[model samples]
Target: MRSGTAPPVPSAPARRLLLTAAEWAVLVAEWPGALPPGLSVEVPGSRQRNDAVAALVARGVLRAPVGGPVEPVPAVAADLAVLRRPLLTVRLETGGRGGRRHGWFALGADVVVVVLTLPDGGIELSLAPAAGLGAELARVVPEAAAVTGPTARGGAPPTGALPLGLLDAAPAGRGGPPPTAAEAALAGELLRRTAGSLDCLVLGRAGGPVGAGQVSWLATDGGWVGLRPHPGGSPRRVVDVVSVRPADLGTWVAPTVAALLEGRA
Candidate 1:
């Protein structure tokens, strides 16, 4: 081959191997730590681990560190942006007393709970109250609380009644079928309690096909917590009053509920 002339193109599998090597370089640069256990790049063909490691060495992205497994040069801002896209954005609002002020970002259906920590060491929790949809809300979140009117003579307002309005309004540009009967009832209760304060509340049913026996619940600060049980559960029950702050409400409420009801947060 002439000097500077490129070799014939490699086979498709070979080309894929090259690409995998390139991706490994990128991953190393983004994560300087050793490949966390169980982390490995997929490759074409049945290649041994040594072969993969050798290919990465040729790419110059991976280098054996004195005391570390492998390290990449510090990533630039542009690279950092690319890496950040997959990350979940969590926003926390703090400012309550006695470790009671906290919020959370909960994933709908997934049941992933991202608890929000406040500056005052307060942790937000949602619970069902006696005033509104008592145990109903508690069944879903087990922490949601109903909020009646203002507090009694000397007591403060309910724990979860922030001034942000009940659920944030649905966003625009969203087109989907209406909620199921159970979801509709849940949304209705939320709306009834927060109507004056909020524009609307989103109620999202489980994405899968709606079945006949899905259950639902509602909670308000000081109000009752109502539980409309599924087929096997006992009759609906209204539980005693619990306390909840507005900040803690969303943490317990499912994001699907927010997304389905109001298109936006």
Candidate 2:
């Protein structure tokens, strides 16, 4: 039941847009296409609507080339949609509450990938069946990586701050880099073996409630998988721990993740 704050205001030259509810609805619905003829006009009847669209265009959230159709910027559209309707909000600190929400989005109901925003203006993603997130979306931020941590058990208290090893050590932010072929292959196989129930585990202090307060685990009935982001790049390395007893997860998962993070595995 946590609420979200207002959309962030951009720095100078990108003023905050005061979009009417009708205008916002239309913009969200008609993205990637030209506005309806009526709303595109600047006549008195439509001046306000047209002005809102123009402001978005000026901010580069929408594009209108000399003769091209006005369209929503793909990356901006993705970001805006997530901001408006986040599936989950995670707080990296154990007792954290209220401010500085880290949003999470399940790309699509059937899609296994989840995207999370980092507080340092970076982004991280998780792939249940490791795969490619298109280059356009990947480049939305300067720093991006795939992260895996401890899953939130049904009733267990939250544990672990969002790990900072990758972010702390990552070099200056740059264009998001796509995952490596090897990383994708490993993820694919891990998901296939786990019957597509795999998810990257995140160990964070607190998170907003999801439906029924249920959270997924990194381990599935088939086995367990641990993934770590490559500290030096966007690609990730994974370890598969199969046929292990549930009671042994404690003994095996953490050590496996540690080795993966240290590049010893």
Report the error of model 1 at residue 136, Å: 16
Residue-by-residue lDDT tens digits, candidate 2, 1-265:
8688978864222112334443454454544233221122222236666776787688676788788877777755554554344332212111011112232322222222333334443334343311222221222212101121222222221222122222222553523454355544544444333321222222211233222221222332233333333244422222322233223323323333233323311
lDDT of 2 at 23: 41
Candidate-wise lDDT, in order: 0.32, 0.34
Error of 2 at 18 (Å): 9.2
Please state the error at residue 24 of candidate 2 in Å.
3.2
lDDT of 1 by residue, 222-241 (tens): 33332222333322222222
Q: What TM-score, to 2 decimals, does candidate 2 have?
A: 0.23
